[model samples]
Every structure is written in C-alpha cells, then in structure tokens.
Target: MGTGLRDRRHGRKDGGGADGRNDGSIDARDLLTDEELGLIRMEEIPGKLEEIKRALEEKVGLGVSFDLVFRVMEFGTKRTAFFYANGFAKDTVLTDIIVRLTHLDREQLVPDTLSSLLNKYVSHIQVETEDDFDKAVQFALMGSTVLFVENSGAALVIDSKSFPVRSIEEPDLERVVRGSRDGFVETLMTNVTLVRRRIRDPRLKLEIMRVGKRTKTDVCIGYISDIADPRLVESLRDKISKVNIDGIPLGDKQLEEAIISKGWNPYPSVRYSERPDVVSSHMLEGHVIVFADTSPSVMILPTTFFHLVQHVEEYRQAPFVGSYLRWVRFLGIMTSLFLLPLWFLLVQNPELKPAGLEFLGPQKQGELPLLIQFLLVEVGVDLMRMAAVHTPSPLSIAMGLVAAILVGDIAVKTGLFINEVIMYMAIAAVGMFATPSYELGLANRLVRMALLILVAAFKIPGLVLGVTVWLVALSVTRSYNTPYMWPFIPFHAKALFSILVRRPILANKFRPSITNPIDKTRQPVE
Candidate 1:
C-alpha cells in the first residue's frame, strides 16, 4: 500500500526538469516534478478496500485530477474498487464490466482472490495480476483499469485503454500515386497492428520497453525473431533500455535523440516511415522498427544515405519506370546539393565557364552582391515554405501563387536579384522537393548552404575542402555502428549495383547482408 508515502524531494536537486532554468515558456505547473511523483510504498496490499482507496487516491490524485476516476462497488459481501484514467477507459465500457462484476459474489471470490476476479469476474481480454502497488498505479495511469479487492495481495489490471486517435489516412509527406492509403497513427497498438497485419509471420516479435520515467511512454521494438540478428536486436534493446530521460514530450523525435547523438548534424541516422508497408518491408530485410507511443512515424534502424533518399513509390511502378524514376530522383538530389554552389563558383570565376557555355553565370549583375542575392532568395524561399506549412490549406495554394507569380517576377525587375539567380534557385528548390525523405531534403539544404558559404570564402579550394569534409564526415558516421554511406565506402559490389538499379522483385534472391540477418536468402534461386 502507498499509505506511508513521504515527500522525498528534500535531498533532491532543484532542476530535475532538464535543468528547469533555460526556457521561460515552460509553465512550472505542467511538469511532473519530483514533489509531484513522490516515492510510494511497493508493499503488498495488506489493508482492506477502504484503506487501499485512501492510499490510491493520495498516490494517483484520483479525485484531484478530473480525468482520473475510482469507482467503489460491492458485489454481495465482497468489496471492489475500479481505478482507471477517465481519458482512456470510456464510461460505457466500465459500465459493461460493472454489470459483469455484479454477478460475481463473495462465495466465488473467497478461496482465490486475484485469480477469481481475473478468471470469473472480469471477462475482458487484457486482464492480468500485479502485486506491486506502484506498478498497479502506473498501469492505471497508462490507461488500464485496475481492480483492488478487499485485503487482496495483488491488483487485477484490465487493459482496456482506448487512446484518442484520428482515422487512418495516408501520411501527408509519404503520399504515393499507387499504394496503400493507410498510414501509422499516434496510437502504439494501432501502429503495431498495421505492421503485424502486413508481415503475418509467427516469428515477428514486438518487444515493449517503458521509457521516460515520468511519461512512461511505451516504446516497441519490432523485428522478425528468427531472421533478425540477435546481436542487432539486443543492441537496439540495450540502447533503448539505457535511456534515463524524465519524459519524451515530442515522442519518437526525442527518443531518437536518446539513441543517436546528433550534435549539429542534420542527417538522420535512422529512416522514419509513416507507411506500415514501408516498415514491414524493412523488417523483412532484418532491420528493427522503433515505435514510440503518440508518434505517427516509426524509426527504421541502421539506415544508409541511400535508404533515406529512396521511397516505396519507386516499387509501385514498372521495373524500367522505377529505374528511370530513381535515376531522375538521384539527379535531383545531386542538383539540390551541388547546383547552387557550382553556379556561384562559376559566377565568381567567369574564366572557369566552359567554351560552349558562356551563359553559365548571371547575364546582369544585380544591385545586391550575387552571394547576397542568392542568400536572400534562399531565406525568402524557406520563409515561404514555413508560411505555407503554418497557413490554412485553402490559403496555402493562394500564397504559393502570389509568391511565384508576383514576388519572384517583382524581385528580378527591381534588380534586387538577377533573372538567372531566380531561375537557378527555383531549380534547386525543385530538386529539394524531389527528395522522398523530408529529413534528408532538409539535410541537403543545410549542406547546400554550407557549400555556398565555403565557395564565397575560398573559391575553388573552399568548395573542394567543403566536399572533402562532407564525404569524410559521412564516411566516419555510423548508424548503430553500421556504415552510413554503406556499399559505397565498404564497397559491396552487388549491393551497390542493386542501389544503382532497381532490380525486379523476382530477380533479387538474397536479403541485404548489411543488417547481418540470420536468414540470408529471400527466395531460393531457380
């Protein structure tokens, strides 16, 4: 029982909430402070129903928090109390369970307490016994209906948690012309089901780990058991278990930071896919999928640069069509990363322009410096992108129209920017959008900006140094100790070939050895 709970915050540090001093926007009231999550007694429930209710109320803020509820009812001579969060278990579901409990009397529950209630009284699917009082409270807070019996040693946790979620729809970012419209939602179980339905393998395993002590967010590590390397699975499990954060407010985004250290690095170590089909495909290739509760996207483990640039849409088309699409996409990604800087370099040293193409640099020098003009346009485009995202859907199209037709045209005529600058920037912008992965696109944008700055400073040598540094950084970087550049640096000839060319489904027989999967062959060669 949690009756003898005391305030243990006296010796505790002042700033448990991530140093608590930096952000002025953070309201002191909202955070689950140490004083708030006081230490509770983990002893067995030795006391009767009334005493348990008092202890539970003090511990769980049963009446204090309007969303938390505790119902006391007696079936014949046996006293029972239902503890659950109001937000999770609906009144209708509770009422139905209550009707069932009414039939269970003291006689049926006398000899065996916890077992009798779980077996006979509760007819629900997810009922289980928990002895620790704190754990029972934790489960209730996480949306399970906990039952406390008179002087019972353990509590019956009925998992009837129905999270508030939206209808399954295609993800805005990962949309495709010819593919499944359904996408993963914020609800963990729903997302799990989506992936499980696709795999349909008995070997498919989902190991659940509770992260963030205060938040207690459910993080599921999904992988195919027999196929996935035990070392890889354990490695992922080990990293997630070591996370000692208080809460993950931003869901998977924050959890990712815990697993992978990104100090000013824009490139994502793991690929995130909202589509279950995309995730299932990865699992088949022996990659682990990390699903954090309240997050729509799931992280695909140990990804490469190539993995981040590709999408499921490529597979939807014919082999030839897919190959062509992939090549064009690769070209766009290259253009996004190099086009602006190369053009700027050419402009700076007009002598570098080839004999055939004298029009490589801007025709007319604008009032602003060429570099200034390029930077201004880049910042302006970024602002437009941000504005489009924040604006209402109906207004977004109109805003885009105004920016394209009115703003770009006006800037060129006013000599604020050259026509060539506007043209080249627009091409670069198109290239950025052509990238399938949003994170990768943003990363490429940052790399582009860095390249521009380097080019302005040291001319040809700066560009060379910048390129060298970028390649070396990526080459040294690892995703779960797996090569980020993979195939290219490690030089897997077959794998590199597969990446360059989208081989037909039947043509590929072996699973990617990069993940070190236990089962290598996908299909036996004829």
Candidate 2:
C-alpha cells in the first residue's frame, strides 16, 4: 500500500498537516527550486505521493484552497485516489467517471486492480498507465485526471482535459476574400485536429513534447514523415528539447527565441499563420510546423524572405490574377521599405535627379531637418496605430479622422512637416499595411528607419552602404541551415522566377530544394 493510506492508517505520525506539508510550514525557496525533485519511479509511489502533495501545497497553495482537487475513493476493499485541476477537467465527464467507478462490482475489482479499472471500469476513450510518478503529477496538473490505486505502483491517466477556448472563426490577421473561414484557436488539440482534417495522409505526423520546467507547456512538431527531411526534423526536435526555461508564458515567440538564437537580428526567420489551410499548404511543401499551446499562431520553420511576402489570397484567385496580386503586393512592400529613404536621398542630392523627376523634391523644406521630420512622422504613424488598436471599433473612424485631418493638416501648416513628406509617409504607411506578415513588416519598418538615418548623414554612399549591409545580413542569416535570402542570394533561376511570378499549382510539381525534402517531387509531372 502507498504511504498515503499507510500515513492515514498510522494517524499522521509524520508531524505533517492535513494538506501534507511537514510541520504545517514549507519554505518558499524550496518550493521555487522544486526542479531538483526530478523523475520519481513507480516503486517510490508511497513516498512520492507525500512529496508531491507537499510540493503542491507549498507551490500551488493549500490544495483545498486552490483549484487542485485530490479525492479519495473506494473500489470494494481497494483504496483509490483521483487527482485533477478544476477548470481543466470536464465536470460532467468527471462526475460520470466517478459514478461508474462507484457502481463496479466486487468481482470486477480483481487482484490486478489497476489493470481492471483501466480495461473495464474507466469509461474514457483515452486512458494510459504512467509508471513515473513525476509524469503522473505533471499530467494531472495539465488537466488530465490521475487515478492511483493502493499497491498498483502505477497511475492511470485519463485524458479528460478541456481548455477554455473561443469558437473557431476567421483569423483577422490572415483573412481572405475566398477561402475557409476556419482559424486555429488557443486549444492545441483543436489546432492539430484542424490540420489533420486537411491532410489525411498517413505520412503526416505530429510529435508532442513538453517544454518549460514549471509551465510544462505542450509543444508539437508537425510534418509529413516522407516529404520532410529526417535530419531537419531531428535538428528542430533537439533544439526544442534543449530549451531549459522555468516557463514559456509567451508561448511561440519564446519558443522561437529558444530554437533560433539570432542575436541582434531584426529579421523574422520563421513565418506564423493562424489559418489551417495556410499551415497545411506549408506542410505539403515539406516545411515543419511548431504548434504551441495557448497561442492561435503556429510557427512555420525555415521561412525565406520571399515566403513572408506571399499570401493565400493569391492562390484563391485565377493564375493570372494571382500573379498580378503577387506583383502588386511586392511593389507595396518595396515602397514601404525604400520609398522614403530613396526620396530623401534624391532631395539631398538634387544633381542626381533625372530630368523629369525633379518634382520628387519637396517644394518647401520644413523648419526641422528632413530627417527629423521623417522620424517624427514615423513615430506619429506608430502612435496612431497603437492608439487605434486600443480604441473601440465604433470610435476608430473618429480617431482616424482626427489623425488624418487634424494632425496632418496642422503639421503641414505649422511648417513642422512638408506636404511631400505627408504624402510619401501616408503612401508608405499604406504599403506597410498591405504586407502579409506583421513581423516582416515591423522588421522592414525598423530597417527603413535605419536607412533614413544613414541617408540623412551621408548622401549616395550611405544609401549604398545601407543596402549592402541589409543584403549581407540576409545572406548570412539562416533559419535552421536554410538560407534566409534563398533563390536570390544563391541565385536559383527557376525558384527566383517562380517567386517573382506566381506559378500555377500544376506547374509547381517539385518541392523547393531549400528544405531538402526526402520526396523531391510534389506530384507527377503529367
């Protein structure tokens, strides 16, 4: 029998309180450094139960006062205990389980009590025996119910986990005109199921692992076993396993940082998508996907510069229309990144201006230096964006009106900003909004700000230097050994051409070589 019943039978002789803490007090320092407890074997179930109960009390507060529930039940003469977190485990399911267990006949509760309960009494579809007491505790904390029977030396884990998630709806960030309105929710199981529903192939595999020592957040790696490179999968799995953190409260962003250690690099190495179709499309192309619990977004690995610029809307339309949309988006991205700096450079060196493009220069220079005015406008645009996010939807139009009419008109009239500055800035802001990847857009904004500073200090040379530095950074940066620039820096003509012009789905018969997919051919050439 476990020490729980032994201790109870012996009348609490260990000087511990009803909550299981020794001397009715535990040091906060001991609870915080509980990682030292490590893995507990099945043989140590009795002592382990006491230690876990004490730890739960010290760390999660008194069990009775907290959401954690530890209930003791009986199956004929055998003693049993149930452990679960309140909100995570479904109340009706738990009630049903208890009712069924209580009705089990004495003959049903054989000598192999744990096996008997698992094979017959437990009505849940998902039930498994966990030999490791530490893992059992972790599962119970994560929302599953852990059933411990006297002298069983193992616990039965019931997957009755339920997360408080909103209804699946269209993702605002990746909305499209003609596509599925379904989007990933905070629930990990739902997100994985969504992807699985789209890709029914047996090769599609999702490997689930726990991250964070304290949080034990569930992280999953999804990829097609045949299409995705074996080495790439191992490399990502290794990187994720090596992440030694107390908790990943921020989810995917924190996991990205841990996996890809890009020190001081502003460029986003991985692409994120909330749309299941988008994730499914990427997976079909041999890319690996990382799904973090509590996050709607999933990280697409080994993303290239071109990947960030593409959108699902392009594929939803006709081939020619898709190509046109792709080109327009590309132009907008380019304008967002370089239009202001190029304009500033032209104004700085009027001699370099072409014959017909002289009007590109501001008619009246503002009181402040051009650089300062540009910087101010950039800050103002960011401020307005932040304000709009916080402002209520009904009042957003009024906020926009105040910013566009009041702020811009006053700044120009007061000589704080030139008319040309406002025009170019507005255009740039629109281009930024047109960008598909929010991370990529923000990175471009940062790079643009840096280029503006460089252009203000030195005319033509600074612009050249800035462009060179940006290209060099891209060329050097790699996401899991795959080139960040891809096709462009390495100069693969076919791939580069495909990026410039959206290729028909039938024409894209081969997966990109960058991922080194095992199955190179996506489909039969015919």
Candidate 3:
C-alpha cells in the first residue's frame, strides 16, 4: 500500500550525490521486511521449481530449470547450492558460474556474498524490498527468479531473464513501398531499441511514463530535446501523468482521453499512425510522440485538420500521382458532404435551382415532403452500411447493391418516394466513404444530415451559411498550437505546393510549418 520511490534521480546512470546509496552496496536485508522474507523459497525452492516445470510442461520454458548442486573449493565445500535458469548449457554464459560455485567456502558464506556475486556475474539483477506476495509474483513473471537460502535473513535474487519473443517485423496497418520496413513490437524495450536505431542523437530523449492503475502500461514520450518546444513537451508529460484508469488496452483511446480538449467533437485533435518514418518526421518538426506499450500506433498531438487528409506514402510516390489523388480526394469529400442534400434541395425547391440542371427532375410523383423522402433514403443507406460491415464481405457487397438498387427501384416504382430524390441520396451515400479514416467518414455522414436540415429550412442560403461556419471552425482549431488550415487559409505560397499536391522528397525544402520544429529546413545538400 506504500507509495513507490519517487526520487527522479534514482534511475540515473551517473554516480550522483542523490543516488549515493545505489552503488549496489546497500544490504538486501535493509530493504526487505520479515513478511517479504517469508515469501523467500529456501525450503520450498525444490518443490516450487517442480511446480513451475509441471505448469510450463513441454514448452520452451528453458528458464524454469532449477536444480541442487554441491560446490567444492580450496576454502571449504558446501553441502548444497541452488542453480535456477533454463538455458545454461555447457556453452551458456552462466555455465562458468556453476563450475566456480563448486569451490566456494560454505562457512564463509554470507547473504551479501551471494548478492555481490549476482551483481557481478548476472546480466540484469533486481532486488525487491517489498515482501508482498503479489509484488514477488510480478517480479518472477518478468523472467527474474528469486532465491531463498536456509538460515539466512536476506534472499539472493538473480536475473535469469529469458523469454521467447517474435523478431521485429514490418507493421501491417501502415505500409509504404519505399520506406524502412521495420515496425515496433509489444515489448517496451524492443520498441525503444527500434526508435533509438533511427535517431541516434542523444538529444532525442525517451522519457518513460506509466498509465493505467493496474495495467501499469509503459508509455514513452519521444521528442528532440533541442528542437522541441519546452512548454509543449512539459504539458504533454503533465497530461500523461494525470491519467487514472483501470486498463488501457489500446494506446489511442487512453491518449485521446488524456490530451484532447475537444474529444467530443467529430474532428480528431491528435494524429495517429503506425509508421516510424511518419513519427520520426513529426519529432524532427517539434511535435511530441506518445507511444503506448503493446500498441503499434503512436499518437502525435495538437494535430491540425489538414494532417488528417495526408498520407506519408504520397511523398514517397510520384508528384503528379500525388496531386491527382489529393484533388480527387478533395472532390470526393465535397461531394460526400453536399451532393445528395444539395440535389434534393435543387430538385424539390423550384425557387433554388439554377438554369441548366432544373429539367432532370421528378420521374415519380409523390405527396411526401422532400425532406421526408430524403430521410427515408438516408435511413435505408445507413441500415445497408451497418449490415455490410457486420456481414461477410462478399455477402455484404451483394446485400448493399441489392438493397440500394432493387429496393430504391421498387420504392420509386410504387410512388413511395420521388425517383430523382432517391437517386441523389444514393449518390451522396456512396460518396461519403471516400475519406480514409472510418471514424472521419462517419463524422462527415452525421454532419451531412445537419447540412441537409439547413438546406431543407432555408434552401441554398442555409447550405452556404452552414458551410461557412464549418470552415471558420476548422480555421480556428490548432494542431499543437500551429494553424489547423496551414498554408491554405493563411496562404503559405511556397509551402502550399506540398499540401495541395505532394512533391518528391528532394523538392521539399522546408519542414512542415505546422510541426513548429526547432529546425525548419529538411532538404539534403546537393
């Protein structure tokens, strides 16, 4: 129940005055209590070892090997000694320790002697002072074995840490044909190693922060110390320190809850991606990255609206292709939001239609209001979408096509809703899926309904007014204090080329202005 040690200087590698007691000289007895001492398995060491072996069975439980050995040395001979580890073959690093233990003087043995040998010989030994059973179990679970010696007050703990894990592989979610294929794994240490390999500068700091009350999930904050804004980094740390949750299964939800001020809004406040290249690019630009253990995705904060529309693969590909895709995406987004509702308003409200397109309307006659007819179509589309996502892929596609085409044809033929209105609604419903992020697509769908209502009430004037308000909101929002509508509304002519259409890596001379990194330029020397 006691608070864990909080002196920030304790974990430092330097021989500083604050951590003078951390010279591996402190007695193990001084740190442990009698209750904790009881958990030490001196008498039951053999039995417990058997229990562990029985549990692990035929698996690669190589670390669970514990056996009794006799040591004979020049000073004296010991009757019994404990050897616990899985992979200590004749060629193993600990094999020499087994051979040397045979000659040690039994009468001269002290708790400190065993502890000193461990600190000197073992690769990663940690001594726990807490006597709680749960705490001891946790330490063992992490691949460390605790040794209890008979007629001794202090227990000797050795770091026989070994566990089989998958090698680093390319991330599945975020893929680029041209970039590095390496991806992060569930292990915190492995993830850190991956980042360190990319950015070797000492200034690239990785500060560890643990979230979740019980999950104790390790979260690392990565940022360039010299390039990053000091205030932003500190603020990010403060927010992370405050998160109190039972569990955080995924890093995105936990970080979103912690840092986002307007999470309730449909728009994303933080940018998330699984690519290390994208993350590295963000860190170079003064943005802080929040990486959660066990999650492949990393969160970069104060993200602007424009960042959502972008993909890292664009820069890696050809410029003309990137520009075409960007324009197509833009057109698709506009159509998704306004196409159906605007069509309904133009076709139904005779006062709002422009000169040319007015003649294409009303193949079917209906007494129902235009709003009512459009609403029915919208509801049907939503049901189809839900069914599609829940059902098998092939079946879902068939069902969606059948429901949209056959059902609409039947409804129009029966004069249940206007034929022109149903066609317009179908066009808009299909267009809404153009946004890459599923959540973003859903947000636009919801917003489209609001736009439709406005158009229904005031016709074209209402649609214009609603769109203006939406643009104003986007312009005001900040991504890590940078303008959300960067290079567009503010008009960065030189930088605007990359936003509207991505250019080659060499063509980009300036780092993204939105990142606000300490170093603004990112072009290689010719």
Candidate 4:
C-alpha cells in the first residue's frame, strides 16, 4: 500500500521530488500495510471526470450501498459527478442546488469551470472546495454533496448535512426540577447551536476537527476566547489531534479514554455533562468543553473532585439554598465512600464504639461473617442495577420491589444477612445513588469495595491507608495539566471557600484559578 501510494505520487506530473526523495534508504512508510496507513482513500483528486466518477463508485461504495447516491448531471457542455449520502443529504436543499446549477449555459462552462460553478451557480450557505480526495470522500460520507467538475483538481463540497436527530428533551441522567428542558442531541451541529444560543458572545469559539481514521468522527472544542487559557486550549487540541485510533464508536467516552491516558484509575479526570446550561456555566468559568459527534454528552476538562460532585440543581434555587444542597451532596458522597467500611470496622471491633453509640455495633450477627455479608450485598446490588437497566421500563418497578421485599426479606430470614448489615448497606447504597456524576459514583463504589477489603484485612489502619492512597493518587493525577485534587491538595483558601459555599452568580466575580484563564473576573466588583 505504501509503495502504491508512493507510485501514485511519483506518477503525477505535479508531484515534486516523489521520484528522487531518498530512494536508497528504507523509510518508515515502507513498514506499514494498507490497513495500517490511515489514508485508505486517494489523497489527490483524479483529474478526469470519468476517473473521479469511477473512484467514487469503487472506493465509497456508491452502487453497493443503498444510502450512498451518485449521479452525473450535465452542467452546460461539461459533466459533473455528484456524491452524496441519501439519508444525510436534505432532499429540498440538494434539489435547489441542482436546479440552480441546471441554468448554466454551454458558453458559461469555459475556463475555471469549478470556480464559476462555485461562485455563480451552486448557491448554498455552507460550501467549500476540497483538494484532498480522501477528505472529499469524508465530506460526502458526512452528508455533503461533492461536485466533481471535469479536469478539475478540487471538488466543490456543498454542506447539505441533515442528520436524523431526536427531539431535544431533557437528558435522563441530568434532569433538574427547574432548568431548560432541552438538552444536547446526538447531532454535532445542533449541540453546538444549543451552546451558542446560550452564549451569544463572539469570543465563544467552537473549533471543529475530525478524528478517527475509519469513522472520521467530528470533534468540537469549545471555549470563550477571552476567558479560556490559550495554553490549556492548545494543549487539549494537541492531545486530541494526536489521538491515533481507527474509530470512536463510543464517541466522547472513547475519545476521553484515548486522550486522557487513564490506565486503571477508576476516577474520572474530566466531567461529562448533557445539559447545555451546565456546559455554558462551565465555559463561563473558563473550562474547555469537548463535543463529539453522535454523542449527547460533552466532556469538560481540567476537572477536579468537587466538579464531579456538583449538580445544576444546586444553583437553580437561592444562593444559601444552593450552598446547603452542595453540603448535603458533599455529605452524601462521603457517606457513599465511608459508610460501609466504617460500619464494618465498628461491628468488627466493638470496643471502638463510643460510650453512647453502643447501638452502632450489630446486635444480630448471622452465620455469615460481616465481610462476606457486605460483599454479598454489594455484588447483589450491582446485579440488581444491571438487571434494572436491561429490564423493560414497565417491569423495572416490579423488579425493584421483588429485590427489596422478596430478596431482602428472604435473605435476612435465611441468615444470609443480618438486619443491621442490610440497614447500613441500604443507607450506603442510597448515598451512592445521590451522587451527581455516574462515572464518579462508580469510581467511588470501587474505592468503597477497596476500603471494605482493606478494613476486613487490617481494620482501622487499612481504611486509613486506603483513603490516604486515594487522596495521594488524586494529588498526583493531572487532567490536561490541572490537578485532580485542585483547591484542596494545594489548598486555595478563597477557591476552596467558594466551592464549599455556592455563592450568588454575581458574587462569583473571578474564574477558577485551576484553569489559569486569561480573564480572571466575569464582572468588575466594587
């Protein structure tokens, strides 16, 4: 494949130095096979209209796939080949473009036919010329109509991408009582529009670039030009451009994993948000957002432990109410992480219980050990969670009832679990469910399990060691150069105070120091 590509380049009269450019020494390009080389499509557009037509049919599966539509229409004396994806191309838009093109006379199709067509005839809001054949193919696959003019090196790409989109409804995970009901849709353009609509400022930059060799997924990086740190934006862009992958089937999730280099760390380095309002708020705070095509969720980078714990619901109410809610959430998160292990420790070492808190120790110790009982319940809860997801919507309530009433009652009756164990575990499970970020909740669950094992093996010291390790790891971990435990490990008193207490919107005059934003303040404060 390398040799073939080189031969094509060498054969082209326009290709300079492809013939005599270090022919002796074996280059690294020689090692790659056809599949390994990301560029499978022809790099240079074939000069002749017939060759371009043939290439489109052969390479892009024009005739093979029902959706990939190809047609040769006469524009004056010259013939033009049209490549468009059927479902993606808007029928009305493409028809209007073609109808407008049919008006060109034979005399009009003279020198610079492609230019004349683009400037005078093909009327569209978004259109561009593509010199690279592979890129042109990608454009066509993305639902744009590519016009291959006879003997022209560049193809006239008409942006007529009209993807099938779901109605903009509130996302299931990030729903709030008082907020915009419309959340981000799967469409990249629509998602950008949603964000853009909220922030009408010209400094709100949304730079798009395609990633994935096979999928060629569209990725949009959004940030306020004046507010966002240029260094951070550039760093993130470089990392994303360097992502070497065949496809991003899982969209933002896969892209996040690829760029972040998160090996075994269960904790999320970046925050994911489906709510546009939430995203806009983050952008204003000088955080950069990554929007991936075919994904409803977008990634907010330079995230911290507190970022994952936060929710839009807190801000929906009064400032004091929001602060109260924030503290409650903080408590819930801590409860999820420590409740199980602390309960286990107390039951294991009854002497550790305080004088008045004698009831904290389990009065009922069944045949099973406390550790085994906790582990069983943990696994059982996970199983039930998975089952709930797969189960039909109508049956989910019934399934939950069966698990809570039937399973729990039976297990307790059969001595598989003690009453105190079930009660404590239930409280811990509720706390886990209260977490805002799903990824963070899951990560906390892993930490909870680790803590449980540690407590079981080494008691008090094990729990301490587990927590210390978690904190130390977070202290060391960086998300796009921003510390994972920012404002806490480094101890930023002002920032930490603001995070702890959700201040009024106008009160938050300054942006987060973690992002190193160019503009420090949102508004002037007297």
RMSD of 4: 8.2
lDDT of 4 by residue, 1-526 (tens): 3355444222223221212221211111222233434645558898887788788778877678888877888888787888888888888988998898788888786888888887878888666787878768866776778888877888888877778999999998988989789999898878988887888875666655667877878787788777888888878877877888989988999999998887999889899999999999999989999999899999998899889989999999999999999999889889999988998888889899989988887677698888888889999999999999999999999999999999999999998889988888888888889899999999999899999999999999999999999889989988888888878988999989988998988887788888888889889456
TM-score for all predictions?
A: 0.89, 0.88, 0.71, 0.88
What stretches of model 4 exceed 4 Å from their correct place?
1-51, 75-78, 108-113, 130-132, 150-154
**TM-score of model number 1:** 0.89
Residues 303-391 of candidate 3: C-alpha lDDT, one tens digit per residue: 76666766666666688887887777777777888887677676657776778766766765687777778777778888877887799
Tens-place lDDT digits, model 1, residues 286-361: 8988999899999998799999889788899998899899999999999999999999999899899999888787
| Window of ten residues with lowest summed lDDT in model 2 | 24-33
Best by TM-score: 1
lDDT of 4 at 460: 94
Count clashes in each candidate, considering only residues at least 3 apart in sequence or on different chains: 0, 0, 9, 0
Kindly provide the TM-score of model 3 when superposed on the true structure, using C-alpha atoms. 0.71
Higher-lDDT candidate of 2 and 3: 2
Superposed Cα deviation of residue 363, candidate 1 (Å)? 2.2
